[model samples]
Target: MSAVRENNPVLTAIQAAHPVLADDLPPLQAVDVAELAAMDFKPRQPLLSPWLCSQDLAMVFAPRGVGKTHFGLAVAFAVATGGPFARWQAPAARKVLYLDGELPGAVIQQRLWMHCPDVDPAPGYLRIFTPDLVTEGRTLPDLSTYEGQAVIDAMIETDTALVVVDNLSAWARSGRENEAESWHPIADWLLSLRRRGIAVLLVHHAGKGGQQRGTSKREDLLDVVIGLSRPKDYDPQQGAVFVVEFSKARNLVGDQAESIELELVVADDRATWRCRTVEASTFERVVDLANEGLRPNDIALELDINKSSVSRHLNKARANGLIKADKAARS
Candidate 1:
């Protein structure tokens, strides 16, 4: 039998009968079963099992510096090597393919060695995408240049069961994420990969309005939508906690409950992340004050950062504080 016949009997049979139905044959280019599938697979359940037990196409959306990369790396290492995730019970370990679109290869290596020494990150198992750029600096493919199909092909070749895309914001072409058509290609590509049973975890930034980034289509394309937020039920310093909630899950059990807390810790030059519950209460208070009487630009000036940074941080801080905010005051 031919290779196609040996691999896919259905395709082989269809092709074999093609000559008989030549008169009724449709243009191959016009035939789009995949596109039809993509349109219909809006609410998919590709990822439902906890941890490594099942393949999951999930996303984590949060503001910057909220530890999405660190959190993802920890989870990927645990899944790759099979151990507890930051001390939580984890599923069986397997090889993980991490596509670091934002961080450099050297930075990624340093992070893994410093934070996850237990993980035996061999070249075969833990892969990195560090194509050379310029003599002055090296850079990975940005969102506009990144092709999900290419990454998928690499994953299949490497037998990677788990894949992580750090910061979807960086991987996607620059534009208004609210535009549906702009994200269609990336969404469709991700869907095609998810159908092949690879667990893909992507990190993205939550929007200014405390919403997930990208159009509603992005959420529809994902099997699991997980949100990271600080607990607004009380003052963060009263042990104000960070939380992980299953914003959407096809197979997971339980109410959208708090899955984990952001452990607050300081790191030195080693890129080490340590967590111990700290008082976000003060931060929350600052945000509440800002929302009530302080302008965002003023707050940013006080914090010595950009207005956009202040806006993002304030959204999260107010969220943690559960502060009812007025648009007029912030304006």
Candidate 2:
């Protein structure tokens, strides 16, 4: 009779009981800023001391064949065994989960063996899930779908502390890397993982300009961004040499962002590839450029130094047996 009251029992009861009560309720919950500031907070543990902290979202980007995966694996091994990696030290051993969207199982196994031949395999310490093996003939997991949920479930079940997505382009479904909006969903999902105290490392490709390929928004959410690149004159026969530069770091302070040079040494049998940190210098850069088949002029231009300086460094490098000069270069 009175406009049917919209068939709402709770509202009708509230209206009949106290007409003025609704106005007295606070619309939102409030917390005291002073109280929040007084609460105790634990500092996050360092996964890679002084660089990558626990629960940090980081990215390692590089051009193809520059050893991004190799470097990622080396770091993963260190974190899993509480060992040292390059110049960084692992504070303690932690569980690691590696999602390999590229590379076959056999190849991954061989690479692991090459890097860790002396150490015995510690199961559950470092777990790997390749697309071929995990999906079992089905399509790879799309992070936008139920498959993504399943992957999260697996991470939880395994008690993973660190998860490495051995590539963003491969694992991110429906993501238009160039479009900022397309990355929102994936970025949010990664942030959610960080919120839960899980660290995530994304391997990505670099553009021709030597920056991570994608919307700059990708870097917005990442705490650390590492760029891997081979020297201008990298020679496979000599050894695999590359640079690891910290382009962006939220935790690193002054001088901490200095670049690191890495060399992959192999045994006579070529059964092992051990990564070691090498000194970075102008002489080393000159030698590398020369070895890469760059002429003195080209090397000078690349290093942005005078041609005379290039020749001086070249002479010094040659005098020290650091580089071999072709007869043509001498002429």
Top candidate (TM-score): 2
TM-score of each: 0.59, 0.76
lDDT of 2 by residue, 1-331 (tens): 4657656543354354332466687676666999878877545788888888878999999998888888888878888888777778788888888888888889988777766634543688888888658655567766644346344444553356788888888788675779998887677678767766788999999998999998999898899999998765556776666878888999999767777677777675333343433334556677887887888888888876778888887778777787764421742
RMSD per candidate (Å) reads 11.3, 9.9
lDDT of residue 120 for candidate 1: 71
Separately for all candidates shown, the number of backbone clashes (residues 3 or more apart, or on different chains) is 3, 1
Candidate 1 regions off by >4 Å? 1-53, 86-88, 117-123, 130-139, 142-148, 155-158, 231-241, 255-257, 264-331
Model 1 per-residue lDDT tens digits across residues 212-313: 876888887676787777654445453313556667776556532335556534355323333332234335544765756677776655545567766666
Model 2 bad stretches (over 4 Å): 1-30, 40-42, 135-137, 157-159, 268-279, 285-299, 302-331
Worst 10 residues of 2 by lDDT: 269-278
